[model samples]
Target: MENRIDFVNWLDPDMSIQILTCLDDLSDLLRVTCVSRCWRQYVIANGLCRQLCLRMFPQLSKVVHVVEQRYGTKDPAEVGSSNFMEWQNLEREHRAYAFLARGCTTFPIRDLISEPICASSTDNYPEESIDNTLEPRDVVAQRASYWSSKGNSNPAEPEMLLYKLMGDLCVITEVSIQPFEAYFQWGLPIYSAKAVRFRMGHPKSPVDVPLGESYKDYENKFIWTYTSQEFPMAQENRLQTFKLPEPVLCIGGFLLIELLGRVQRQDMDGLFYIWFAPSSLFNCSFLVFMVNCCELFQDQCASTLIEYFVILAIIFSHNVYVTDQL
Candidate 1:
């Protein structure tokens, strides 16, 4: 009877889907699917299961740029349909609104600065293109021309955003207080952020401050000697905040490109790092589901494909639990 009860519990697909959909725990559902072929088939065939999966697959727009940076492709043509364009704009506005909800009155300074620099008013291509009179190459050139006009006007390279900000010593000092991956390695890919810190200026007094002194004692001694108006307490704190080597920032851009280059290499597997915290992981999963639902405003994909991938990703994440139990 105990074995019978265990068999019934293990065989339950409705219960698996319920936990996945209700708890929003894809990892657990995924684990169950990996347990046997039956659960996988049931998930694939169920309408509600498909709907849930479709709702989770589109939360990848931010990382889309990173993928392109790694792979050297523009946004896919399929993702640029009129409906998808509207959806993309809507998502941006919605994100802005959500940030506003959390008291972020301003968006990232980079976005604000880049807008007019890279702005274009062009929408979907001409009806003639849709009607197939223009050759594919012509259509590509026309689209490129539209974007080129906007980007060429005072033409901003993306790297310029970082380089211009790099020498601004005052701003670098401010970033030191925050340990976010951005402040330490602005141009590096997100995963290479471990132990990175911000640095700004040289150590004072023409000799190294020994590592033996407590931070407070070092500060007190520096404050007394560097009394010159040029390097006051505030300036000392700013300079002291420099933790990571400044030279790393110089190599950051090239390192990013190199990391992308090695991504497909087998030996490079050791270099990949998982930096997502539990909260961030949960939030991303939720966003994927939300984007899937809100995607109706843009290029539409069949709900079935969305369902397929989301469920699969969720199942794969269950390896975490299986490993933990062992």
Candidate 2:
């Protein structure tokens, strides 16, 4: 009987890399690393993960340069070591991409908000409390139950929402907002802002300042890290996603959402509404493979579907439980 030769071992290293490059799934790529020492070495040597990350998020190219610059001036002895410099560079890229992937892959929605944060607006009705929009839930009785500011005479004055993330550091890629639609009304008027802006940073002092001092006072003290471009908001009640021009590395945890312009309700008596839900505020991480797949098929299909069912499955299997509170 002839001995069977392992194709992977026989194949040229470059050919193996080319074959592996076709795999877009991060999990699958990670699995390949565990197949054998040869496979692992080949994958690491070529910096497959780093390449995949860069392919997914071109913005990561900037990060790669920053990393290179930080570690460039190594000792001559270290540099002279056989493939040591190459290996080190690849490892650094792998780590950076892994960190970015963690932020984008699985979003802990429940853990997103650090505390019971509220917007700087008066709650008009108890039913339409701001807290209602914090989590995903079915529409309650088809009523416009959402947080609304008191009737503002001048719509130009901006209304703001202040909140903090669960983590001190966050790489923000996208922000989603949903305006409240008064479906119960005749025309189903959607209360939305003409424009929206975001600011992220850390406060100079502890944010536990007295309430009477005002949020504006605390906001003025914050050292902003990034300010997003003013995105035009559509006057639609449904959830709308707005992708930032670039990813923002927010060192500080605080986030401020500014709603601009006055949208009047034709049904309501001259009252301007800035109605929104806490559920509307979504900070989406950019998943490279999913996004690329979507774009690839976008022109062929009427709609693109990029579902993170893994996240949902995990949540259902672990986080959810039957309670006896009833």
TM-score leader: 2
lDDT per residue, candidate 1, 1-326, as tens digits?
Answer: 45434342475766655655563344454455566675554444443333432243221111111100011223443467897755444433333222212221112222111011111111132321111211213234343211111111111211100111211111110122111121233343332212222211212233343322223333322211000011111211111122221112110010000001111111233232211111111110000011111111222443232211100011111121000100
Which candidate tops lDDT? 2
Cα lDDT tens digits for candidate 2, 68-151 = 222123443355566776667666556555545545555434335554355566545455555555546536666544667667
Candidate 2: C-alpha RMSD after superposition: 14.0
Backbone clash pairs for candidate 2 read: 133-279
Question: After superposition on all CA atoms, how large is the RMSD of candidate 1?
Answer: 25.2
Spell out the clash pairs found in candidate 1. Answer: 30-315, 55-289, 56-288, 56-289, 83-298, 83-299, 84-298, 84-299
User: Per-model C-alpha lDDT, please?
Assistant: 0.22, 0.60
**TM-scores, one per candidate:** 0.20, 0.52
